[model samples]
Target: MPAPLIWLGAACLGLYASNKANVAYLKHHDIVDAMPGESDQKSIPVNGSIVTCGIYGVLDHTGIWYENTIYELSGKGLVRCVSPERFLGNRSGTHIYVACKPNNKVLANCLAANRARKQLFTLLDYHLFDQNCHRFVAEMLVNHEVAVTSFSDLNTFLSEFFDVPIKWNRALVKK
Candidate 1:
């Protein structure tokens, strides 16, 4: 009947709904539609100097994908490929890119939150944890697939992903 207990209860209820919605969303439009299968979305090829795959629309399918390639199309229709990682963060000039698979959708909200925080850490350039700290997040983000939006939502993701904190430095990752 204490204040903390009431707050905790409300928080739990909210999380339950958030989790449910996230799962429902992943199913509704198929966040992992990029994976090859019967539920696959669609891929279009850009006719340039070479063959390249493009996911149409403002595809919210964001996650920790590898540094595949970055392409630039000139008015002349000339296409060039580079590294998506080093050049991504696109409009912001520093947005981290991610990719998720069928299972990557598992990170729908949990890991998405963590990776975003990890990014915020880097953006602020704080060495609060070890240099290798980001690697743990990177591992989770690249966990076969993930879709984090920014570098400021880590704490929320931590609660969303794991019910407990098993790491030492993890506490520092929180606000």
Candidate 2:
């Protein structure tokens, strides 16, 4: 066999091996799997009735959902409000894990305040390790006296500090 052909075969094998390893790592870390037609909408509370606060992502990305809108500080240095259909849609490969659903009045007030403080709410301030999307969500929830620590600390914080039930929903990945 030609040397170049042998090297090409080896490279293909290496790529396949690395891909499998990546999938295993993601699963070990509890990253939600992407199945066909999966969706997060089922877990979302009825609009204007309950505020479902939670994070949605696999391993590489994550965002927050409040009421009907999903908010996240994108890597582009902006806080974006994505529609539920876009956020949890099959195109994004994101999932929803409801940490807590607070009272309707409380959620309404939070949403109102979130709208009123537009400057603070949609600021283009993004820090990956210190002040990322998770931090933004945690701050907003904490300000409303709803306990949440950070993106990675979600389940533990919600379980220990709040009485609201937690729910999970997996969104589909676009093929």
Candidate 3:
């Protein structure tokens, strides 16, 4: 066997090991898994709750739930509010998950909703991995600059902000 082939096999094994370790770390931190299609029954979200919906079963789009609508950052960087149906439209999944406590109690801060509402029609420089929906939601909650890039990152921030482990509850779309 060629020496280069042996080195390539070693590198592949190392990569696999690194991936497994990363997964273990994320699970240990209690990062909320925002993957969609996990629930069938619809649920009502509390105002100011952090909501998320799956995008193509791989990414999660986040927003702040206020009143009967969801305040989200559009792909074009416009901050707007929309109905739950509109939120799920054109998405790969139909369920929107709300952030809650481990005991299934909805976790929310009214101030977050107020902040989001105040920012309506605001335009931002949206970046897919940097200045995206997650950062927008985080900012709405904290009213400060928060660098959140992924669902798990936002969940971790929420856990610390609320001082508890965060859980995802499927939100109900009222007719």
The number of the candidate with the highest TM-score is 3
Model 3, CA-based lDDT: 0.80
Q: Summing lDDT over every window of 10 consecutive residues in candidate 2, give the lowest-scoring window.
A: 100-109
lDDT scores of the candidates, listed in order: 0.30, 0.42, 0.80
Clashing pairs in 3: 43-172
Off by over 4 Å in 3: 1-24, 33-43
Q: Candidate 2: TM-score? A: 0.46
lDDT of 1 by residue, 1-175 (tens): 5999999779767856664565455445433232212233222211111111212211111223222333332222222333444333333322322222233322233443444334432322223222122223433434533333312222223333543211111000001
lDDT of 2 by residue, 1-175 (tens): 6999999879767856664565455335544232112333343333221122222222224445444666655656677766656654543443443332322111212543363235334565565666655555555545543333343344334323444422333322222
2 or 3: which has the higher TM-score? 3
Q: Can you give the TM-score per candidate against the true fold?
A: 0.26, 0.46, 0.81
Q: How displaced is residue 56 in candidate 3, in Å?
A: 0.5
Q: Candidate 3, TM-score vs. the true structure? A: 0.81
**Cα lDDT tens digits for candidate 3, 58-170:** 56799998877999999999999999888888998777888777666778989999999999999999999899999999988889998888766787788889988776778
| Model 1 poorest ten-residue lDDT run | 166-175
